[model samples]
Structure formats: structure tokens, C-alpha cells
Target: MVRAPCCEKMGLKKGPWTPEEDKILISHIQKYGHSNWRALPKQAGLLRCGKSCRLRWINYLRPDIKRGNFTEEEEKTIIKLHEMLGNRWSAIAAKLPGRTDNEIKNVWHTHLKKKIKQKQDSNNQQLYVTVPKCDDLSVIDLSESDNSIIPALPGLIGSPGHSPMSPQPSSSDLSTVTETSGATAETDNIKVEKMDSSDMFFPLLDQDLWSEAELAENSSMELASDSMVAAGFYSNFPRIDDDNDMDFWYNLFVKAGDIEELL
Candidate 1:
């Protein structure tokens, strides 16, 4: 099956877009959002092809797009992914956040590919250096000439017995992990710690306690009314009336400011 050329014979603008064109495309996208690229150019009021508009938005105009040079981590990811999935830039871009496939392709072709080739060539030259032919290969002291050889490809780094990285956790470390897990399980069996008024910093007065306190205070006010208690009387009043009736609200009266702050 044949696919149509992106722009075809349509009189569409090409090459770099102007600032005004960028603004119009951005405004159109912000207002309606991009759903159909084939119909976007007409709606966006641009002479560019749908493909051009899509590329512009995806590579540059998108708000979340990352600009500037590729990071070291990104470079390593690209190289490793290329070794596994060669030239599949879209797949490579999917692994790297905010990077477009087109940008990755350009970077590989323009820079990274050449650098890899040069290194490979240098290693090849070093490995092919002149050495005297000998029937007894064991007699050659290769220990002193180690740096003249090319290092093995880093792709084989983590294989068994070949890696320079730390070995797998020892039996002692595994035992320590088991002990820690056992301690955590034992902790789960412990009873939940109870909180008191001091811990809460607020007196937990139930409805019954609040009503009883209001009634007592009202009775006290009424009794003192006949005798005309002074203005500062309630402020200086002895609140612990009886051990039997002393309740949660009495504590609330003393620490009302703290409770107010909490509220």
C-alpha cells in the first residue's frame, strides 16, 4: 500500500515557523485541544501541513517538553536501548521523559554514532598491534601488557563471575533481614496505645457532662444573684464542688483557651 507524502502538492508552508505562526497554533491548541492532525492546519489558521503542526507541537511548543542538551543518564539510556533496539527512536524516546523521537534520531546521527565508531576503531587498532608468533602461548607474560588490550564490551557487565560490582548479599545479611521482619511482626501484636486528655491537649467533654456543668453554673449564678456576688466572683470561684460530681467539663473550664486554639 502506498502512503501519501506529508505535504503532497498542497501549497503548504515549510521550513522554520515564524513567532506569529507559533502563537496562533499554540492559541488554537490551548482553546480546543488537538484531536485530528489532518484537520488541525485548517482550524489553526496556518499554511503549514498537518504533519508540520504536529511536529511543532510535539517537539517544541508543548508545555512539558524538555529543552537544552541531553543529560548523561539520557545519553547512556539511548546507547543501551540502541544496542538492544537499534534505530527505533520512538521506542527509545518513550523511555526518556520529555524527549521526542526526532531529537534522539538527530543526536544519534550527528554525534553519538561517530563517537562510538571512533572508540571502536581505536580499540581495534590496539588489539591488532604487532606481537611475535610463538607455538607456546602460555610463555607470553600478558599480565604486564593488560592495558594494550581492548576491554570487554560493557553490555556483559552484570553476568555471573564477570562483573566488578558487589556480590549478591551474604547469608548473614539474609539472616539480618529475617530478624528485622520478625521484629516488625512482633510489633503488630502490641496493643494500641491509649491517649489521655493531656495527650490530646483538650478535655473530651461528652454531652451529659456539658449539660451537668451548665446546669450547675446556672444554679450557682441564680443563688448568688439574691446575695449580689461581686464582678470578679466567678473568676476567683472554687470550682471543685464535690468529688462525686467533678467531671470532664471542669477540666474544659480550666483549659478552654487551648481547646479554642485547637478549634
Candidate 2:
């Protein structure tokens, strides 16, 4: 069903209300209460529609109507109510005293919407972290080529100003020292060979010397056995004799701790 227009009559005033019209409407409503808004305009002798009169009274002419700028508390209440009630301006106005739905709706569109947007923008800015661009950064070289020796601190164990203790050698320094020591050992062995047995100290025997001597002795024995076999000295000897000899030497080395000590 379609509702009829507020004023179907030929002439009814519209637009901004005049002071004379306001005074008449106020006086009439004060004398006789507006029970029927459609008949109120005719009874009050005002040239306005029923809907126009109702809006004017509710939005402006009411005795309890607040006319000035909205307070901070009222603005906050409107914002909270708007979040809960959404675009229901009448429902939101019910919670605020002396405020009409039209006033609240106007304030929301004109002021509150912009304020909420600005607040949201400020919050979004706070959430983002500013990262420095790659071009702004500098590269640092911490490779061995840059500095071979890292100087000790003043309070540390091997620092120059503190103890007489030296800095620990690097891997390259250790390897160089080992090579120089090995060369000096070879030179000392040559010198020891020229010295007499009575004047010389016992030579330091390593596991490599024992292995080389054992290999040479085994090669000589194999050559002798091949020669004996060719001469037919042991015709009944099995081919497994060489294997038995190898097992015997391996077991002897296992039982005896070192070949150097046995020698």
C-alpha cells in the first residue's frame, strides 16, 4: 500500500521557517497539544505542511532541543551507537537526550565520518614499520684478506698492555711451523749419520720406519722362495706357505704392542 503525501491541498508553504511562523506554531502547540499533525497546521493558522511542521518542531522548535555544537561526550556516544545501530539514525537518537535523528544523521555525514577515517589512517600508519632501502645499506668485508691477526683487547689474557702471554697462532701459522720443523729434522738426521755411534744418541723410530722395514724384509723372503722353488729345493711345499707366513707376522704384531719395541 502507498502512503499519501503530507499535504494534498493546493497551497502549503515549504522551505526555511520564518520567526513569525515559529512563534505561531510554538504558541498554538503550547495552547492546544498537537494530537493530529495533519490538522495541526490548519488549526495553528500556519501555511506549512503537516510533515514540515512536525520536522520543524522536533528538530528546532522543541523546548528541550539542544541547538549548539555537539559535546565531546555526545559525539562519542553517537560514534558508539552508530557502530551498533549502523544507519538507524532514529534508534541512535533515542539514546542521546535532546538530539533528533535528522541532527544526528547530519553530524555523522558532515563531521564524524571524516574524524573516524582520519583516526583509522593514523592507526594504520602506526602499524606499519619503515624498512631501509637496499641502496641505503653498506657492505662490510670480514674476510681473512682484510686483517690476518685480530688484535686482543686491553683487559683480555694475551693483550699487549696486560700479560706477557702471546696471541694463539692461526691454522696457516701452525702448518708453516710443522713444515719448517720437519725440514730441520731431516737436516739433523743427516748430521747424526756422520757422527760416531758412541757419541750419538738413540734415533727416534716412527711407525712408518717399522712398516717400510717389514715390507722390504717380506719382499726379500718372497724373492728367496721364488729362487728356491725354481731350484726345486722344496718340491712338497704348498703354495699356501706365503699366506701362512703373512698371518703369522700379522698375529705377532697384534700380540706385541709395537714393531719398534720387538726390533
Query: Of the candidates shown, which would achieve the greatest lDDT relative to the real structure?
Result: 2
What's the TM-score of every candidate structure? 0.49, 0.48
Clashing residue pairs, backbone N/CA/C < 3 A, model 1: none
lDDT digits (tens) for residues 1-263 of candidate 1: 89878785567899998999999999999998999887898998899889999999999999988888998778767776775567789999999989999999999898877765554444333322122222232322222443223112121212233211122333322111011122343222111112121222222233343333444566543333221121111322223334322332222232211211111
Which one wins on TM-score? Answer: 1
Q: State residue 141's C-alpha deviation in candidate 2, in Å.
A: 32
Worst 10 residues of 1 by lDDT: 254-263
| Backbone clash pairs in model 1 (N, Cα, C under 3 Å; residues 3+ apart or in different chains), count | 0
Give the alpha carbon lDDT tens digit for every residue of 1-263 in model 2: 89977686678888899999999999999999888899999999989988899999999999998888999889878876775557889999999989999999999999987876654334222211122222332222212222211111111211222211123233332211111123342222110011122321223334343343444456644433322222222332222224444443333223212211111
C-alpha RMSD (angstroms) for model 1: 31.7
Give the Cα-based TM-score of candidate 2 against the true structure: 0.48
TM-score for candidate 1: 0.49
Q: State the local distance difference test value for candidate 1.
A: 0.51
